[model samples]
Target: MLVTGGLGFVGSHVCVALAEAGYDIVALDNLANARLSVLARLREIAGRRISFVRADVRDGRALAQVFRRRPVAAVLHFAGLKAVHESVAQPLEYYDTNVGGTLTLLRAMRQHDVRRLVFSSSCTVYGAPESLPLTETHPLRPANPYGRTKMIAEGLIADCAAAWPELKYALLRYFNPVGAHPSGRIGEDPLGVPNNLFPYIAQVAVGRRAKLNVWGGDYDTQDGTGVRDYIHVMDLAAGHVAALARLESQPESFTVNLGTGRGYSVLEVVKTFERVCGRPIPYEIRERRAGDLAQSWADATLAERLLGWRARYGLEDMCRDAWRWQSLNPDGYPERPVSAAETRRRRSRRRS
Candidate 1:
């Protein structure tokens, strides 16, 4: 199987799960938003060496070469820019990487007669939920470019499936994926600044950052802050396995939500992190950013019924695992190990 962006947070965990399930993994990544060292860690956890392809999914020739060389059973496309604020600032890049790259991949898959795919979609496609627990049939009114790209990709996959009658696809729309592998050797490593809440709280707990900025404290929620359905990375990865099994058994296209069907406010997360890390997570209530929602959770009934999968971890597990990664790797995979030369380069880049 081919796994794009297999070195990333969710992607890496999926690779580990897939490897344990006895799948031969060909991991393709550009390392733009991930680190090369992550592949080593994945090998360590997976207990086997995986084939690594250092190529971008947007490069048609490079992607085609992989298909030409091997008989890929299926493709798990996870290579894309996924920052909400960054997507707003650079809409074209996001579209080119997310939408355009997906198109390139689909064409290559079609060329090679590989008609099976497991796409990494997001719950952002739901926008603000019309009701409490969002189902797969919920209206897709994405409010941001990030979500728009996902919706577009889903449409493209559907079109591709229609064209190729044998094509099987599973679009797994995930909620907030937090936590790390229990081994603590691999985790989420966002470039520059993190756009998610858990990483920011982990940073504060680890003393890498000053405090957490609780965005939007005036929303109509339990704590007047935005509430999100945070699912553990492992649980989310297992859901992918289940989805793959379903796709293999029945060659049909489907979309499902992978979430715990529970919501937690910002304060709730911070307090949980404090309990997990044994450090007070100092935070400030800031203004609510535009396009933010009040509360969003999933109706996981479809996943449970179809894939026979349900999220098992809660807020405490998420915080504890994330804290383990943050505390162990506060610097988050530095290029060089705290040497004077590395320090000078970091300082120089900051000044520039």
Candidate 2:
């Protein structure tokens, strides 16, 4: 199996899960927002070396070469820029990487006769949910460029499946993925500042950041802070493996949600982390982010019914595991020099 962005937070965890499931894995990444050292850590945890290719997903030539070199039975697409605020600032880059990358990948898959795909989609696609406990049937009305790109990519996959009836895909629309591997060997290590609550809080707890910024304290939630469905990364990773298994066994293509089906408020999370880490997470109420919704959780019934997957971790487990990773790796991943190839790619992107 081929796992794009396989060294990233969610992708890396899923890679471990896939490896444990007896799949020979090829992990492809540009290392744009991940560390090369994670390859070693993954080897240590999975007890096997995962083949890696360092290339951008938007590079069709590179993708084609990967297909030609390996017998990839299926692909778990997780490559793309994911920051909501960053996408608000840079829409074109988001579209080019997320939507354009998906197009390039689908074409390569079609060319290679690899029909199975498990897309790493987001609940952001169902922006500003009209109803609570969002289901797969919820209308997609993405409010931000990041969300828009994912929605567009999901459409692209659906269109390809319609055109090529042999294609089988699963669109796993998950909520906020938090925590880390229970082993604490690998975890979410976002570049620079974190845009999500879990990492930001973890950083603060680990003394990497002075304090956590709690966005919006005037929301309609019980705590007056934004509420979200936070699923453990391990649970999220298992969900992907399950989705892939379903796709391989069944001829039907489907879309489902992967989440805990319960929402956690900002203050509530901080309190839980404080108890787990035995430290005070200093936080200040700030203005709400531009593309954020007040509260949104998942129904996740379809995921359980169809894929036989449901989140098993609670908020306390999330905090405990995240604190373990952050406390162990005080400064996230180690800094490494940019390769000549990566430098060239950046320059080319700048010129284009």
Compute each candidate's TM-score over C-alphas. 0.94, 0.95
In candidate 2, what are the lDDT values of residues 207-258, reduced to their tens digit?
A: 8899998879999999899999999999999999899889988879999999
Report the lDDT of model 2 for residue 351: 100
lDDT of 1 by residue, 166-198 (tens): 889999999999999998899987766788998
lDDT of each: 0.90, 0.92
lDDT of the structure predicted as candidate 2:
0.92
Candidate 2: which pairs clash?
A: none
How does model 1 score by TM-score?
Answer: 0.94
For candidate 1, the 10 contiguous residues with the lowest summed lDDT are 334-343
Cα deviation at 202, candidate 1, in Å, is 0.5
